[model samples]
Target: MSRRLLPVAVLVALVAALTASSSPAAPRQRPRAPSGLAFYRPPARLLAGRHGSVIWSRPARGTLRLAGAKRALVVLYRSRSLTGTPIAVSGTVWVPKGRPPKRGWPIISWAHGTTGVGDPCAPSRDSPTSLAHGYIDYVYPELSAWLKAGYAVIQTDYQGLGTAGPHPYLIGVSEGRGVDDIVRAARELVPALGRRFAIAGHSQGGQASLFAASIARGWVPELKLVGDASYAPASHIADQIKLVGAFTAPSPISALGAEVLYGAAAGSPAVSISALMAPPALALMPQLEVKCEPQLIQPDSFGGLAPNRLLASGANLGPLLALTGRQNPAVSIPVPILLAQGGADATVPKPFTDQLAGELRAKHDRLDYRVYPGITHGQIPAAAQPVFMRWVAQRFGRR
Candidate 1:
C-alpha cells in the first residue's frame, strides 16, 4: 500500500509542529514515574541469573485509560549487554481488556524510536504529559488499537535506558537482545501470554526489529518469532556519517549522528570517542549523558552545529563505521518482514531505506516493502499503521 505525495505546505507544517513541540520553549511539566528510581536498581546477585528472568515488578501508575489497556506493569528483567555481560533492563507490559483466547494472548514486543541515550529518556518512564509525550501521544494510540485487538504489548526500555549502564544506543546486538529478552520477561511475569510473538519498531527501533528477527531464533529459542515490522527504520549508518560530515549548515538530525558515535563508543572499547569527534563536538558530550532527543535537537544543542563541525578534521571513522555496518538490517531475515518508508523523510532519507529494501530483496528475504510519498519520518508509523496491523495479524494467524 502507498500514499500519493502530500502538498509541500502540509509537509512543512508537519515538520514545523514536530520541531516546535520538541523545542526548548515548549511548556514543561514534571513527568510521573511508574516506580521509584530504586526499582530500576536490581541486586548484583539477580544479574547472575539466566537472561530474561524477571527481577521485580510493580503495577503501572498513571492514566491507563489513555492506552486502553486493562492491566499495566513496569518490570525489571535480565538481558545481555553488547559484550555479552548480564544486565538488567526495564520495560512495561500492557494486557488487553477482553478475555484471553484458549491458547493465550499473542505478544508484540515494541522497539521504540530514538529517545536519546540518557537514562531519563526511557519510554517506560513516560507519563501522559511527560516530555516524551508528544511522540508517545502519536504512537500510543496504535498500541491501544493493538490492545483492543487482543494483543499483549510489551515495550522495552532497552539496555541502560532506565537501568544502570551506558545505553548502547543504536548498537543492534544490544538493542535486539533487549527487544527479544523483554518478551521472555513478560511471559515469565504473566503466564497468560503465549509463546508466539512478533517484533516491531519505528526509526531506531525499526532497525532493532530487524536485528531481533535475525537473532531471535538463536538468542531466545524458547519463543517463536513469527514476523518483524520496521517503520522508516534507521539503516546505512556508514553512508549517513559520510553525508553528515559534508554538511555546511546546522541540522537537527545531526543529533542522531552524534548518537551513533556515542552508541558505538559505549558498545565497544575499540571505538575511541577522542578519535571520532572534534573538540567542538566533544565539548557538548556532557549533554548527551542527560538530555533526551527533544533537548538534544534544540538550536543550542546538536542542532545548532553543522554536521561537519561535529567531527575531527581527519577523523578515523573506521571503527565506528565498521561497528555500525555490522548493525545494518540489510541481510537475510528468517521470518517474513514488513518494511515501510516515507518518501519525504529527512532524517532517514528515502534512499537509505530503498537501498536496504533492495538488499533484502536481493537476499530473497520475505519482505513487504511500502513507500508513502511525502510522509516525514515522524508520520510514517501512523501512515503505515493499517497495513502493518493487518500484516502482523496474518503472522499470528489472527484474520
Candidate 2:
C-alpha cells in the first residue's frame, strides 16, 4: 500500500525469505529457467497430455525451495485456456516431511495473485519468498501452517507466466483451470497426494479460487474438494473498472485496470490493445515485457496516465466488461466458502466484497465472510490465519 518507490525489478530477488534459516542474509536471486524451457517452447508432448496431466518436472533449487516441505518440484503440466484450447501451465508443489496419513496428505491448491503475464515473472520460477515476504503477506504463514499440518501445497503460476501463451491475468476461468490442473498434475506426479483438498488464494487468486470451486467437479471430477478460502479477492471488476476510470492521480487500482485491460486484449482475438488504450498508454505496453505488479504500479510507470485515458473515447467496453463478469460469475457454489476481507484495503475496497457476500447469501451459498477491522489487503492473509485455519480444520474433520 505504500506508494513510495521501491526497486520493482528486484522483486524476484527478494525470494531469500523462503529459506528456513532466519539469518538476515541478502535476498536470493531467482533461479534460471530450465534448459528445456530456454526459449519458452513446451515440448510438443506436453500439449497432448490431458488437462492436469504432468508433462515434465524437475527439482527446484535456489530460491524456489520451500521452508517446511520435505520435497519441492517444479512442474509443467497440461491445462486449457478460457477457449478450451490446449496449453501448458507451470507451478511448484511441496510435500511435507514425515509419513503421510493413511489417507495421504490433503492438498492445498494455492492460486497466486497477479505478478505479471511474462514468463520470467512466474512465481514458481521466481521466488515464492515474495508470498512469504514480498509486497504483501499473501501466502506465507498460511502455506507454511498448512504444511506443518501435514498437507501438500501446489502453487500455480497460471498459464502464460511460465509457459507460452498470453497469460489471461484476471480471467477467472484460465486462472481457475491453472489451479485445478496443477492439483491434478501433482496428484499424478506423486500418487501419495490426497484426493481430498481445499482451494485457497489471495487477491486475484482469491477470485480464481472461487471460480475453481464452480468448475472443479466437472473439470477434474476425480478429486474431492472440501472447501475454499479467498482473502481480499479481486471482485466486482466492472465496478472497480469504473472507479479506476474516475481516478485523477496515479492509483494502484488504475494500474490494475491497465493490467487487466492488457490481459483481456491478450486473451481475446476480438480485443486489441490499441482499441482499449490511448496511444500514450498503448506505447507504454512494451514496458510490461519485464515489469510485473511491483513495477507496473509504480508512479513512474503511470507517467501521469489515468484510467480514462486507457481507452478510445466512447469506445464500447461492453464486450470486455462482459467478459470480465462472465469469467468471474456468481453462480451458487455447493461447497462451504470462507471469504476474508480487510476493512482498510484500498485496493479491493470493503464494499465490493460485502456486496459479493450479500449476493452469495441470497443465492444460499454456504459462506463464512469475515472482515478484519483495521487490516489492509496485504495483511489479511496473515492476520486472518487463526479463523482461516479453524475453518479449514473443520472441513478437514477437525484436523
Candidate 3:
C-alpha cells in the first residue's frame, strides 16, 4: 500500500493569502513606526521572577480585542522552556462584560494551532482586518462565543512564536507549560478572574491542551483546571514522521515534516539538524526559522519536495523519533477530557486520534471522545463548537 500526499490545494486553502503580498498597483503607504515588539523582550531581572508571574501588560489595541470582550490586554509573562530554563511568553487576555459571579469570571486558557514558528505569526500581532486575519478569523468567532458566554479567555503565543527563543513546536512540555502558566498570569493580571479554567485548543493546541491537563494540577497548583477540550488534536507524530520519511514525491505536508524536524532539534540537544536533514532541506532551514506556515508551504518552499528528500540518506532518525514520541498526548490526564476528531481531517488522520482516544480509554482516564462524520481538520473547531462549548461550560459548573 502506498501513502497519498495531501493535496496542495487543501493545505493552501486552509491558509489562504497567508503569504500573499499587497498589490503593486496599490498606493504606497508610509512605513509603520516602531511598535511594542520590545515588550516581548523582557528585562533580564524579570526572568528571575516566579514562573507564571506577569512581567508586563497593556491594553490590547485595535484588532486584538475579541468581539464580545469588555476589555483586552497584551501581556508578557514568565514561563519555562522545554529544558526548564526561564523564558518570557507573549499573549492576550480578554475579559467579559459585567462580571462578578461570586468568585469572578472562570477562564478558558486557549492554545492555538500552528501559524508558524516565526515571531510575525504571533496572534497578538494580528488585526481583524490584516492579512494575518485569515489565521485569526477561524477561531475568532469561537473565542467570541466563549467571551459572550462569560468566560474570560487567555491565548498563549507559545515559547518562541512571539518571544525570544527557538519555538519548541509540538514539544509537549514547553507548549503545555505555556498554556498552564498563562492562566496564572491572567489571574494575576486581573484579580477579579476566578482561578478555575478549562484548557481547550485545536490541532497543535489540542495536543497542548491534553498535556496541560495532565500537568496543570502539578505545575500550577494554585489554579483549578476543570477539564480539557481538544479538537482534532495532533497525535501519532512519530508515526507521521515515519510516513513522511517514506514519501518519494512532492508532498503538501512536507512543510509540517520540516517543522517537526526543526522543533525536535530545537527542543533537545541530542537531536542534531546536520545529522538528520539532507543538504537540500538543510539549505532551507534559515527560512523555517523566520517564515510563517504559509510561506514555508509555498510550492517553492518545502511544499515542493518529497518528505524523504528532507532527511539525509540513511539518517539516524532514532533520537528525533524518540523526542517526538515523548510528545504524544495519549497519556493519562488528571481531569475530564473532551476529545473530538474530524473524520475527513487529512492533517491528523482519524485513525491517529482513534488510537489516542483508545489509549486514554484503556487507562479509564475520564474521556469523552467524538468523531464528526464529514468535518475536515480546519473545520473541527467550528464543527465541534456547540459540543465543546457546552462541555467546557459543564466543567465550569455553568449552563
Candidate 4:
C-alpha cells in the first residue's frame, strides 16, 4: 500500500509539471506611443461621435517642463469634427510667464508647419511628438520669445496630425478649418482674446496661416480676425510637383506616395486600404504609412503617377486638390494680409511664393509682400522672426 501511494504521488507531480509546461505565457508589454495610443485603438467614427466630442471637455492638462522653463499648457478648447462628429480636436493656449492680461490683449493664432507629410505621424502637425521632430520644435524658440513679450498665443494641433483620422494630406480647407476653429476656440476661452488676431506660419503652415483668414468667415464667423502674416507660403501645386522632380537632394517620393495611399484610403467612400494594395505593398503599409508620401510613389520625376494596383489607393485627387486650394484664385475678403517669402525657398519655390504674392496682389492692394534677398525656404522665418514678430505685435497694438 505504501509503494502504490508513492507511485501515485510521483504521477501527480508529473501531471502538474506537464500542465505547467503546456500553459501559454502572458505577452510582454511594449512601450506606448508618447501620445498614449499604444493601448487605445478607438475608431474614427467612435471618436467623432457625441460621446467622443465630450472627451474634448476632459483634456489632460498639465505643465510642460522644458529647457529649464516650466510653461503651462492650458487646454483651451477641444473640438468636434465638422462632419457633425465628435473628434478630440485639442487646442492649447500658451500663456507667457506672466499673470493673465488685466487689460485686453491681441491674440496670435500660431499655426504650425509639416515635418513629415504622413498622417498622424507628421512632426509639424502632431502634438505629442511634434515638440521633438518638426517645424514646431524649431520654432519653439520664437514661441518662447513671443511668450516673453506678454502676448496670448493659441496653438492648434490640427485634425489628423495630433489626434486621429486620415490626415487630409495637403488639403487647404481641412487645414484652414482646423486653424480657424482653433482661433475661435482660443478666443472663446477668454473674452479679451477677441481684440484682434493675426495668423502666422511657415511652409505649408504659411499657406494655411495666410488662407485661414479667408476661411474664418465660413468656419467661425464670431472671431474678430483682423489680419494675416504668411511666411513663404505655397499656392501652386503644379509648381511643387515640378520642384520635386528637380530636387537633387535625397527625396521622399516613396514615403510621400504611401501617405497619399493612406489619405486616399481614408477619404474615399468605396475603398479600404486593405482592399487596395498588392500583397507586398499591403505588408509595407504598417511601417511605411508614416514614412510614405505621394511624391515618392512616382516611378520617375518625369513620369505621371505610378500605377498603384491599389483600388482606392488611386482615388481621385480632385477633391484633395480642391480642398487644398480652398482660398486660392485670391479672394476679395480684404483681410489685412502680410506676405513674406524667401528668395531661395526650394521646397515651396520662390516662383510659387512669387506667384502667391502676385495672385494676392491682384486680389488686394492692402496686402504686403516682402521677398527676402537670397533667403532660402527654411531661413525665411528665422531671418524674419523679429520682423515677423514685430508685424504680429503691431496688429495686436503691442508694437
lDDT per model vs. reference: 0.84, 0.76, 0.84, 0.54
Candidate 4: residue 265 Cα off by (Å): 5.9
Query: Which parts of model 1 are misplaced by more than 4 Å?
Result: 1-35, 63-66
Error of 3 at 152 (Å): 0.2
TM match of model 4 to true structure: 0.68
For candidate 4, give the lDDT.
Answer: 0.54
Over the stretch 1-399, how does candidate 3's per-residue lDDT look in tens digits? 223545666677766553222101111221222356887786676676668877778788887887999989988888988667889898999999885688778899999998877788888888754434576668989999999989999999999888897888899989999999888788777877887889999999999999988899888876778899999888889888887756888876888888888889789999999898899888888887667776777888898888889888898889998999999998778789999999999889999999999898998899999999988998988999999878987898887
Off-target runs (Cα >4 Å) in candidate 2 are 1-40, 128-138
Q: Tens digits of per-residue lDDT for model 1 on 214-249?
A: 989888876788999999999988778877756889
Q: How would you encode candidate 2's per-residue C-alpha lDDT over 1-399 as one tens digit per residue?
A: 354535553564465443322211122232333555553466565476468876667887766566788888888777887777888888889898889887778888998877766666787766544422253234656787778878898899887886786788788788889988888888767767878889999888899899888889888776789999988888888666665556666555556777788778766777667777878777778767667777777777753577766766777777788767665546577799999999999878899899889887888999999999899988888888999778888888865
Instruction: Return the TM-score for candidate 3, rounded to 2 decimals.
Output: 0.89
Q: Please provide TM-scores, in order, for all candidate models, with all chains considered together.
A: 0.89, 0.87, 0.89, 0.68
Model 1, residue pairs in steric clash = none
Summarize candidate 4's per-residue lDDT along 1-399 as a digit string, tens digits. 698699899999999886543222222231222344421234444343221112222222322322222243333233454354555554556555545565455567777765444444433233544332444456767766776776667666566664556665445555666677665554444444444567777766776676577767655544567778777765665333323334333333434444445544454454355654546445556653344223233344212233232224344445444443443425444577777888777556677777777777777546878888889876777778877777776776665
- 255: Cα error in model 3, Å: 0.7
List where candidate 4 sits over 4 angstroms from the true fold: 1-35, 38-71, 74-84, 117-134, 187-195, 242-250, 253-288, 291-329
**Is 1 or 3 the stronger prediction by lDDT?**
1
